[model samples]
Target: MGMTRLLRQPFSHPALPSVSFASRTIIVTGANVGLGHAAAAHFVRLGATRVIATCRSESKCAATLAGIEEAAGRKGVVQVWELDYSSYASVQAFCARADAELDRLDAVVLNAGVATRIYEVAEEDESSLTVNVVSTTLLAALLLPVLRRSADRFSSENNLTVISSEVHQWAKFPERDEANIFGSMSDPKTKTMAERYPASKLLQVFAIREIAARTHDSTPFVTVNMVSPGLNKTSLTRSTKGLEAAVIKIVNALLAWEPDVGARTLVHGVVAGRASHGVLLDHCELENDALAPWIETDEGRRLQRKVWAELERKLEAIRPGCVAAMEGKEA
Candidate 1:
């Protein structure tokens, strides 16, 4: 994002319309706190029939639900489920439960993600890449049938939104040229944390664009989109320390939107019409321009297809038959 846009975000975004979600069932990952927590509460306050809030720990459920209910001034609508994006097994298990249990799944906000300056590995890859790109897309794929079924069954507009970031525009993504893009990303010897989070978000944009295009039909069923909630005051920077944390704090204080305000962008993504399909929703509207300029170039398109292929291969290795099953429904 440009300096002008970043500084204007907290001040210029207008109030979102109060749209009711009555009779809708929604899911939000990373709902224990931050934008996810606030978004879950907003769904409840808007009269959603149920909000399946997912966190990394079961122990956090009670307090998380309590806080959401308290914030909404409503209770019993939000239920916290356990999910660990670091584990493919956890992501699959959560989707399995959603498939088996929910009668009507209205929307899913894949908000669970991490931001770190450390070079830690999780699920056999760089931690941020695994959680933010691989597992997030995996969960989105695994939930496809459930969202489609809900649309077919209830004749409703069901959506799946992955929380993205405007920071993606800043990612140079030098690894895009590597023969094995993900392999290059996972290499600690070449990996750099300075742009890791932004690159991961860029990968998300690539994956979602491909997923949305592949899933598109004359009459679409489940609406799929990504949202950049703008810069928000969240614990996403909790891992940074000392001078880095201090700098971030100062920047956020000057520019970050309140979590609830930022989360309205997520809620807007869900309610956004089929027009939002295969696109980035920013500031509560379809934002094709928010994408990096290179994304429209020929090389960027090729890399997007490559990223989707690699991501599908990774998900299939983690859970056999999943990619094929999701593809079977595309046409």
Candidate 2:
């Protein structure tokens, strides 16, 4: 069956008028499920010319594609691409393929991530940092040209929206001993998996800010911003069982919103609107107070520089060509 025929429900928003994606091309990572899937479906439904629903496996993407097409009311509107964020080689390969297939990328939602799992290292010497932070940083660097191309074609509103989380508030500044993000996992005194997950998310916020700053002066039209989706029910939370689930249920009932509702901020960040470059948004609203204190800190800048340098070194080791492509080139 074709994909569009399967979608039956249209996304609803009482506050903001429904927006369409006609003629735009959006790349949604981890699009096989959860907020990624919802965002992909919403874009296709709004008339996006091309929606790349990227996932780690094609076989696993079938249901997502089907659901997206159904939601969009068209066949073949959503296309699946393989992207294993944990593998530097895979990330490079995906970029090469994306460059060939797409002349422009209107928006790239870096939505793929992991949580509540055992510590693991990606291809690069970095821990899961390679996957969650390094890979995302490199991908944006590589795709800036395409995003700029799209901005040239569109108005000044085109942007790159990064999916971040509120967990960023809890991240510790990168320390000498914690260079390897997973190093703490080995410590018996380490905090829970939930805490570690939030720390990684915090790194992403800094990465987004750095990328935004790097690109703003040159390509003001192509803004970059971070979006924090408040807690929602998704596969990432599947690890919650028994008492954990009960606690989550209670907490969610009090604070968490639906997946589509949570995705609103990301969607708003990408669409033409009042959003500013280098800003962090929460629930479709700019987070001035939340991000202001961190951005003003010397510690934040130091951590940003350290992480950026380390990621650059790791990427170069894994894919010299990609590093060379982004070197000295203004995104």
Candidate 3:
């Protein structure tokens, strides 16, 4: 099928007949608001059997769940799962619960992330590397067994789609300094939030490729792809100040699509026509030549491997049993 045809098939819009999800299950992280919430609601409307809308707090997730249920005319079909991406224990706990309760997870939307106002270290010296990189990496690793089991139980084709950003093009990898990455910076030029945010996202793209490379030989049906939503008016962008906010607001008003529109590309990445096992996509299609430089770089790959190694060390320190458990299961 053509790319456009595949991308448009799963989501036809509210006026059209919703897609059937009689047996499919989906998990969307950070579903409490913004893109995650929109994606979860869309999945529910499409008739997904179960849509796990995960958030760090149950109370914060209430409104999102209520709105989705109201729109879908169902209650139990859409449930809440508490997941704090910053905490390794929380990530493990959520994965364990999912393994026990859910029959299978057809799709996992790795959408949760943090764009901090200031550089802050996590449990380790990992700042952006921790929340954006390590947390996501560990979550995917922890859930891989369940994802594989689900793929086996449910047909064969399963999907893992991570939400990356177009801004990743501006950052340099491999040369990142852990001290500067999470260090205290008083200078505006040295501590720009956009730079840090994009760097973390770049890491995610490489991680996606690494994951695809590792899994492709054994699991051809489990497609791993990265999705860039473009610039949408989500909570992530709501805090911009001065001319920056004004410029973004105007641009978003003129060209920025809705959260649902942005999410269309992500959903398509998961269920669309054949996507390259390790490709990075923007707005439902592979990014053009202009965006290729950011994703394809020896430096990027080196940085990704380094980040993975550092993450493994940190996880081994905090969650001693997790790495061993995941390795044994995948073995």
Best by lDDT: 1
| Runs with alpha carbons beyond 4 Å of true place in candidate 2 | 1-17, 125-127, 153-157, 173-194, 272-275, 321-331
lDDT of each: 0.87, 0.68, 0.69
lDDT for model 3, please. Answer: 0.69
List, residue by residue over 1-331, the lDDT tens digit for candidate 2. 1113112113323144278777888999998878888888778767888999898976887777888788668877888888998777788788888888887678888888877555445663334465667788778777766677667766535667777776666655334247644344334355345466666777777777877776656643577777766566677766657898788677666555566666665677786343567877765666434463664588668777766666666666666655444432622
Q: Which stretches of candidate 1 lie over 4 Å from their true place?
A: 218-220, 328-331
From the highest lDDT down, the ranking of the candidates is 1, 3, 2
Candidate 3: give the clashing pairs. none
For candidate 3, report its TM-score.
0.83
Candidate 1 per-residue lDDT, tens place, 1-331, comes to 6677787887787476499999999999999999999999999999999999988998998999999999899987888899999998898899999999999899999998999999989988999999999999899888887888788889888899989987898888898878888889999899978899999999999988888887786233778899988888999989999998999899999888888898898999998888998888778867546778888899889888888888888987888877655553432
| Cα RMSD, each candidate | 1.6, 6.6, 5.1
RMSD of 1: 1.6
Which runs in model 3 stand beyond 4 Å of their true positions?
1-19, 177-194, 287-291, 318-331
TM-score, cand. 2:
0.84
Q: What TM-score does model 1 achieve against the real structure? A: 0.96
